[model samples]
Target: MYYTLHQLQIFLKISELQSITRASEELHLTQPAVSIQLKNFQDQFPIPLTEVVGRQLFITDFGKEIARAAEKIINQVEEINYKTMAYQGNLSGRLKISVVSTGKYVMPYFMADFMTENKGVDLIMDVTNKSKVVRSLELNEVDFALVSVLPEKLKVDTVELMPNKLFYVSNYDRKFPKAVSKKYLFEKIPLIYREPGSATRNAMESFIEKNNYSVHKKIELTSNEAVKQAVISGLGCSIMPLIGNKNALKNNELKIIPVRGLPITTTWNLIWLKSKNLSPVAVAFLNYLKDRKEGIIQKKFSWIEDFINV
Candidate 1:
């Protein structure tokens, strides 16, 4: 039942290269050594394998099938080896992560950089709204989640990475200043708010309730992109994460509300079950994150320097 991998490699190389000379060159083996390995393989397998047509040699149908199976075995062996090495160093398993839609702008910057250094690690991701990000972690559908609100009374550990300041953005033509009181900010602008039950909506509502401020009449919508488009068209002003419309801000399509207290400031946290058994790969990535626990943005993302401890 056991066969030498060298012999199997020899068979596969020969089957693929066809010519003995070419297979030998491809394997960095002398022709005679290639021949001997194939001979060993044929003797061990319970079937005919090689034949000659004039001066050319060929493998039988069963031989080619066995060669294909050998490829699978080699692939599996390599996968195991890479995983083992990655795990031993720190990270080496499938790490499933979930994040709020806004994190689509932030998390990948860090995740990709870390993964680039860990050759053996693999990352799986799900991006959704903030509420679903928390639910996925609580339901164990994902190992970790990036979200704005940290769930209380849950057996989870959270690391705050950065401050995501919500800004009231409008076209510069609106002539809003850089610092406005909470009362003045809400009273002046027509609000373009996120949909009811949305995480952003919940956060905004809590802030408004705590301050006892009445917001001006405004439109409510679901899609972040749509909201940005509305703001660009000057349909009205809306509050959004800096991460949410960093591009629009950069492009000068919209500007922050001059009144500073109108929007709000919040932090983003990475959450995971306190008692979850992390795979080696996941652990490697997590540890790497702890070291860089600040936050990451795209190469040019402006958030890296924003976190005091990062």
Candidate 2:
């Protein structure tokens, strides 16, 4: 059997998108060209790679197995290219990181300088919830994971980055006393909550449980942005990370309520499993963070200290 790397690439893209048209669009090729290549690729194997049902394309089980192998091959090829660049005295490789949703606001600032200095490095950052982020780290799918809360069961080493403060905030239009009691806020006002497995949700729950307060559950949202929008729309107040609320708070779209024991504080950390070997790109990034994290926090996030004080 004979197959080219281009064929493997096309098959992988087709499997990922499950639509020839979409794969073509993403690959920057015409639909006819993509279909022709896909047909040629499939001809090299006896088993069917894909099936169409009611005009919707779906990769078959066999296709999925092939796609997985194709991905490994492509990654290896990319690594070979990166190695060549490294030999030429250029830093080049893929850097994959999985971060909790709120970390999206903070991690980019830390990465901006490193990414600028390393032009040949390809950064693949996934912004997701805590459970998925942890899972990615556990499976060694990503070089590192950014989170406010450390996973209890995973034995990992962490580099502390900065403070993550959670605040109880409501729509600016909502009227409240200068200092509302925690009991009143929890018992009377409806509280929007992040979904289970979110670090923010875990923090909020711990605070409420500690204070022996019972909250009125309004609705559950999946992301920090969604929860912020809900609060801004006056749907309900929510306990949110200050990082995700800076813009809304600055614009007076949301207002933080003053209460004792407010602004739950946690440290943002970059974590990796102790057992995994660090790639050159990952080690460079870790070194960058170790050397410059304090400066980045001072420059980009000094405003957070001022906001919390007020």
Candidate 3:
């Protein structure tokens, strides 16, 4: 192919943002320059890489495949650069991480600390639902993934981070007696669930199943923010991770629906594919987590401890 890796990188960025303008802004290039490079790159493919519809840019199926290849090439090149830097005793390169939407609450602190200490490290964090995070790890698109639950089927290395305690919560206006039973919660309250395949939803379902209780799932939402909004609007109650809902809980916008044996506890784990050759930066991060796990969690998650019994 006549296209340069620089052009391929731009193409991948455009595919991600689906806007040449946004890609150009991120790449520090002018829009016309980005468009020109994109057009030139697309010309090399027999089929069009993208289509413009209603002023919106959409990557064609062919474009997606090409973008995937571009992603691989970019990662390999980054790996080589990172390895070379490692030989020279430099810790400078990009680190890609995929995090479950809920992990957004905690990861920024860790990222900030790491980046502050290592000025040359660039971190890319994709905040998505559990399924996409797993897919990214499977594709080796990210160096690591921050998740609450580990998939048993994928051969991976995991380091336990901290407890991810889940709570049954509802709008502050919703009435909950001082104490209630699982039966009362199941029969009285409507359950708002995260989308299917979500780790939070799965954990809630597993709790119900383990306790031999039936739940009334009334609403399904795509994101944690959506679920919180739905609950706050008095649509229904939801089982959610306490880490993400600390502010809402502290402000009394949302309240715990206290029941017997409440706050089902899960764990947060940092995972990576076992077989993949991890870069030096990735190894350094793992080591950082291992060596400073307690201080990091205590410093970042200490606010949560006052509210929940961690």
Candidate 4:
């Protein structure tokens, strides 16, 4: 027979007070009624639960065993209540995020700040390239991904967080033809670029194709930093994020190629599986992003345009 919650509670109250009169008084039941419920439970099992001592009632061995186990249950129940209260009062849980290599530079700041307010929460991240991140999300390997591009057929949804303006840059000494033109962008200078499937590479190609231009040669540099280094060495010019090149620009180690119709702008965006429901931690982090000043993605990144203009 399935025991009811009411039966379990009655059993626990009797175990605590250890007397039918006391338990009955506390539970507002007649003593005989309390005795009947307890006796019914005991009879369902093998326990008799009663032993008559001289002028007193005492519990039998099996009854004491059940009582101790019930006490443990009661302790655990109390602990659960306390934890529930705490959880409702503040955000608490683990947040596992996957980010594109570039997002590793910015996304973590929000994660860090969110964890500070909700100190008990855990933040874990898988940092990978754009392709691997999408793969991981499709396989349900991460809570969400921070990405620059979202593929059309990928089982994912995206929020355009901020515009990631792609610009052409070259070493201070790598002088190009008269005041950057379409042919100069496409044909004259070699491109220090990312891997073939990179969003930056795709966007750059789209711009090139749309403008009716073609690159004579490109020197594929796999990383933004590496591309920056290559451009700094006068190897070639490259398209990269304004944030990525801000410091280099400030130091005059590089200069944005003065190309008209340059900076192929795309969103440095957030992506997630459209079918996956976000867990509490992930939702709270996203809401937290919408709450704070630096937490808000697009508005906080105004310095991007400033970096380009400066």
Candidate 5:
């Protein structure tokens, strides 16, 4: 009954992490300071909130319940702050978005100006595989989902933002003829692939099937950076998006192979469920994208065109 919000916050952090040490590191407080706060917080309650055995710290059942309550309290407090800012004619709230891995390259550029203008807004972006991004969108867990491939099952509205071009790339040192054959690239060359659930992998598979090319799958990687590094290491070539490979292509770490029907293209879209009501911040972001997407692409992503054309 007599606990401070600071104490509740510390306890909540400790409960979530189950480690005073880790909670301190995340909270930017010294271990001793966190320990003192946790002890003070525990003193006000009659029941045990946490326990330690061997080397592991555990939050008790009651502690977990309290942590849930604490989270609600914190969220409510944030809402109050946002409401205060809104009353002053400022758009203020958390803007949450989940993006497919390749989307990391594109979404941030779109968000940068909006975030700079709205200081009161909090941006939470999760960069994950396509399946997870789609799941987040399906659950309405995020305000928007950024992806190159549209989910087939979701009834969603989308704002088309930019072109996502996929191309075959190899180590810069690898030699290719002026006009490379798709059959040679797929059947002869060892090809790196992304893991199954990746949008890039789906795109690559679709291309291979469409062309009836039997690919030699050399290695499978989970992320774009990994696939890029693998190709750079001379492991194999991959069909990768030009957006993520610009620096590599520019620096000659990787080279685009000019095969026929190269640079498979898709539009990067910001999608939200049609049934989900848009929050003020979410609506503002959509409006911002409508007004500024072309300009943002022209400024930040125009370089990608050169790579795609190769």
Candidate 6:
């Protein structure tokens, strides 16, 4: 019953990716090498870690428990290494961040700049839904979670980063008036909505309920990109975040309709569990964000006036 931390890491990567090939690609190892390592790691435990069904891999409940423990071990080792490195006055460590889907457009810029400045820092970023991001924060799985709507139940420390604005968008060919009334929006236009549980969908629903209005959902899509494509294809209009649709709007693939009371504005926030121990890298990144907050605002959202005033 012997397994190296490296093997545990390989197993965790495979579990995360759910594919040997993908894990191999991410780890820079060949498929066969990854498979051998996974097998060796699994042999150390009596219970099956993973199961293959119809060419797809899935981690069992036991495997999930093992992964949880493995993550803690990995974090502990990383913390020890970084603490030692800190004594040497080196800024070399890993920063794990989980960001909501919409943050994909802006977070890379932050990561790129941070990584460029601290060449020894490794960044592990997960772009996921708000629910998953919240879950990660609750589990202390990441150093920080970036999201628009902070969960009310979680005991978290949050810093507002920027604004997240949802605009009513449609194909440019629709030719709707720039400023239509809310009544006209609900009655005259069919809506293409995101699937249930999405932050955008939930926010829009809450807004509708608060305003005592009902909008028809003619189409439902899982992702923002899908909703944008549906609008581009003339399926129906959707309330979308302007963060990810910059290119689309710029190219006239989708136009922001000037609906009255449009652009439901929300604030982007960086949240982390207050109970979790903050690593040096996490502290550094938080400080970096604070120091560069103004620059981030100007760089990421300088064009907001164009949309807000449209």
> Model 5 scores what on Cα lDDT?
0.90
What are the per-residue Cα lDDT tens digits for candidate 1 across 1-310? 5679888788888888778899999789999998887887788777878778999998899988998999998768767977678558744556789988767776787687788886666677887876777778888888888887777757888777777767667765665556656676677677788876466777777767777878777788776777878888887777777677756766788776544354467777888999887766667777887877554533445543442121
TM-score for each prediction?
0.63, 0.89, 0.80, 0.66, 0.88, 0.81
Among all candidates shown, the one with the greatest lDDT: 2
**Worst ten in a row by lDDT for model 2:** 301-310
Model 2 lDDT, residue 180, Cα: 66
Q: Please give the lDDT score at residue 149 for candidate 5.
A: 87
- In candidate 1, which residue pairs clash? 90-284, 91-281, 92-280, 92-281, 93-281, 177-258, 180-259, 180-260
The pairs that clash in candidate 2 are none
- lDDT digits (tens) for residues 1-310 of candidate 4: 5655566678878766667788899899998898888877777776566666774667778877877776777657655754675668866666778887677666775666777888657667887677887788888888888887776777776665666777777788766667657687668778767887666777777777788877888798777778888888888877777767768887899987656776666676677888888977777777776677344454556656665553
- How far is each candidate from the true structure, as Cα RMSD in Å? 13.0, 2.7, 3.9, 18.8, 2.7, 3.5
Worst 10 residues of 5 by lDDT: 301-310
State the lDDT at 261 in candidate 1.
51
lDDT of each prediction vs. the true structure?
0.74, 0.91, 0.86, 0.73, 0.90, 0.84
TM-score: which is higher, 3 or 5?
5
Q: Per-residue lDDT for 280 in model 1?
A: 65
Off by over 4 Å in 6: 1-8, 28-84, 177-181
Where model 1 places Cα greater than 4 Å from the true spot, the runs are: 1-91, 175-188, 260-263, 294-310
Off by over 4 Å in 5: 1-58, 176-180
Candidate 2: tens digits of C-alpha lDDT, residues 118-184: 9889999999999999999999999999999999999999999998888889899998767667888
Q: How many residue pairs clash in each candidate?
A: 8, 0, 0, 0, 0, 0
lDDT of 5 by residue, 1-310 (tens): 7877788899898987789999999899999999998888888789988888998989889889988998899889999999999999998999999999989988999999999999999999999999999999998899999999899999999999988889889999998767767788899889999999998998898989999988765679999999999999998999999888878888989988877887889999999999999999999999999899889989998787666557
**Any idea what lDDT model 6 has?**
0.84
